[model samples]
Structures are given as structure tokens and as C-alpha cells.
Target: MLEFKTTSPEETFAFGQCLAKVLSAGQVVCLVGDLGAGKTLLVQGMAAGLDIQDAINSPTFTILNVYEASFPVYHFDLYRLEDAAELYDIGFYEYTEGDGLSIIEWPDKFPDQLPDEYLWIEINSDFVNNGGKVNERVIRISALGTAYEHICEELKQICPFLP
Candidate 1:
């Protein structure tokens, strides 16, 4: 597990960019966070790191957005999903198991459907630092299996400044 506190959007985004360097296709990153928790900002930075020049926004209505970068990136938002079964209609399984990097926001809503071996990131406001601070977030990252565990280890080595 890796936990870090980011004081601003830029810092969070930078962390995302740093994280992207260690990402590859066929990997899933499940995100758990509340509204306006910088989830989209992190995704934007990841997109930048992947060399995706297009706008990266939360696919709240569309559910998923695909972007071409160093490798394919599939961003998904489950906030609007009324039922977990809705994932099937969007062919969520295919994308999750496909040759693309999948970053999912609000994944805790469908814990049963989440991939068993993936990275899970939980972002929340850091109220302890809320004194006059506009945005501060505590990001916790965990690896579920050997593959993701290796990735987490690599992330720790590459981004030792993530405190």
C-alpha cells in the first residue's frame, strides 16, 4: 500500500503522470472517491503522460471514454450507473479485459464486478489540512495481486517523492 497527500490539483496531476509511466495495457485501476475529489484531474494527468492530447473529462453520462495514446486508454465513470448490471449493456467486461489501460471512477459501487487483480486507489479530502487550504487530498493506493503488486513496487521506486 502507498499513501500520499497532495496539496493541490497540480500535485495530484503530477502524481498521476508519474504513475502513468509505470502503467501498461490490460491493467485496471479502480478509483474510489467522492465528487470533486480530483479524480478527473488525476485522469487528465494520466492522459497527458500517455501522450493523449485530447480533453479528458469524467464520462459521467457516457459511462466510458476511449482515447488513443502510447496505448489505448479506457476511462469509465460509474456514478450514474443505477444498477451494477448496467455494466453489461456497456460491454464493461470486454473493455476491462481488453488490450487497454482501464481507469474506473466510483468502482466501489460495484465491488462484485471489479477485477480481482488490479490497483485500487482511494482519494479523499484531507480535512486536517483544510485550514485556509483550498484543495488537499489523501490518496491511498493498493495492489491486489502479484502483477499489480509489482507495479506498486515500481511506482514506489520511481516516485520516491510521493509523501
Candidate 2:
């Protein structure tokens, strides 16, 4: 597992960009975090790193957004999903299994449906009551399979400070 802390949104985004440098096709990244944990911001940085010029945003209502980079990027938001069955309607399996990169938000909602091998990213924010240090976030990343393990290893090289 790799863990790091970011004191501001820019740091988080830069971390994501560093992460994107090691990502390739057929990778699945599952994000777990609260409402304002900067998940989308990280994804935006990843998209930028992948050379995707289009705007990146959470597809809370649409469920999925496909962007074209060197390879396709399948971004999914399961927050609004009322049932796991809805995953079928949104072609979750298809996109995730395709030769593309998949990033999922709220993946904890249906953990059983996720691929056996994926990169799990959990973001925890330290919210101060007095509105001090509001942007502090602790991010933990772990790999579930060999491929993902390699990604984590690459991340360690790119982010030397990761513990």
C-alpha cells in the first residue's frame, strides 16, 4: 500500500498527474471518498496527464463519461445509482473490461461487482470546524493484482515521498 498526504487541492491534483504517468490501458482505478474530497479534481489532473483535452467532471447523473486520449478513458460515478442492477444499464462491465482505462467513484456501493484486480484509492479529508486547513487530505492506494502492483511500484518511483 502507498499512502500520502496533500495539504491543498493543487498537491492532490499533482499527485493524480504523477499517478497518471504510470497508468496505461486496461487499468481500473476505484476511488472511495466523501462528497468534497477532491476526487474529481484528481481525475481532472489524470485526464490532463493522459492528454485528454476535454473537460473532466463527475458523471453523477449520466453514470459514465468516455474521453478519448491515446486510449479511451471510462469514468464512472455510482453515487446516484439506486441499485447495483443499474450497473448493467450503464454498461459498467463492458467499459471496465474493455481495452481502456476505467476510473470509478463510489465503488464501495457495489464492491462485489468490481474487477478482482484494480487499484483502490481512498481519500480522507480533515475538515476543521473553524475552516482552517480545510483542504488537507490523506490518500491511500493499494493494488489488488500483479499489474496493479507494478503500477504501485512505478508510483513509488514517481512519488518518492510516498510511505
Candidate 3:
């Protein structure tokens, strides 16, 4: 596992941009975080890193958004999904199993249905004594298979402070 800390949204986004530098086609990245945990912000930085000019928004209502980049980026938000079957209805497998890169938010909704090999990221925020947001986050990244393990190794090089 690899871990890093960010004190601001910009730092979180910068981490995502650094992460994107090591990603490639056919990769699936799973993001687990609470609401307002900066998942979308990180993805926005990834889009920028991929040279995508379109506005990157949370696909809460749309469920899926396809962006044109050097290859393709399939972004999915599963927050509203009540059943794993809904994934099939949205052609989730087709997009995820295709040649493009896949980034999924709220994948914990159907954890058992995820691909066998993928990148898993969990973002947790720090709160003040009064439970107010502090704009601080600890991002934990891990790999599920050999390919993803290599990716994690590459990430360590990109973010030397990761430990």
C-alpha cells in the first residue's frame, strides 16, 4: 500500500495529476471516499493531465461520462445506484473492459463486482474537534493484481514521499 497526505484541495489535485502520469489504457481506478472528499477534484486534475479539455463533472445523475483524450476516459459515479444490476444496464462492463481507462467513484457500492485487477484508492478527511471540515486528507492507494502492483511501484517513484 502507498499513502500520502494533502493539506489542501490543490495538493490533492496535484497528487492526482502525478498519479495520471503513470496510468495507461485498460487501467481501472476505484475511488472510495465520502461526499465532498475531493474525488471529483482529483479526477479533474487527472483529466487535465490526460490533456482533456472538456469540463470534468461528477456523473451523479448521468452515471457515466466519456471523455476524449489521447485514448479515452470512462468516468462513473455509482452513488445513486441501488442495485449491482444497474451497472449492466449502463454498459459498465463494456466501458470498463474496453481499451479506455476507467475511473469509478463509490465503487464500494458493488465491491464484489469490480475487476479482479485494479487500483484502489481511499480518501479520508480530517475534521476539527467540532466536526468541521479541515481541508486535510489522507489518501491510501493499493493494488489488486500484479499489473496494478507495478503501477503502485511507479507511483512511488512519481511521489517520492509516499510510504
Q: Each prediction's Cα lDDT score?
A: 0.89, 0.91, 0.91
Reference-based TM-score of each model: 0.93, 0.95, 0.94
Model 3 vs truth, CA RMSD: 1.7
lDDT string, candidate 3, 29-134, tens digits: 9999999888998899899889899999999999999999999999999999999999999999998899999999999999998998999999988876665755
Score candidate 1 by TM-score against the native: 0.93
- What does candidate 1's lDDT look like per residue over 44-118, in tens digits? 988988889999999999999999987789999999998988999998999999999999999988999988789
Q: For residues 39-139, could you state the per-residue lDDT of candidate 2 as single tens digits?
A: 99889989988989999989998889999999999999999998989999999998999999999999999999999899999998888877655558889
lDDT of 2 at 23: 97
RMSD of candidates 1 onward, in order: 2.0, 1.4, 1.7
Residue 25 lDDT (model 3): 93
Better of 1 and 3 by TM-score: 3
Candidate 2 TM-score over all chains jointly: 0.95
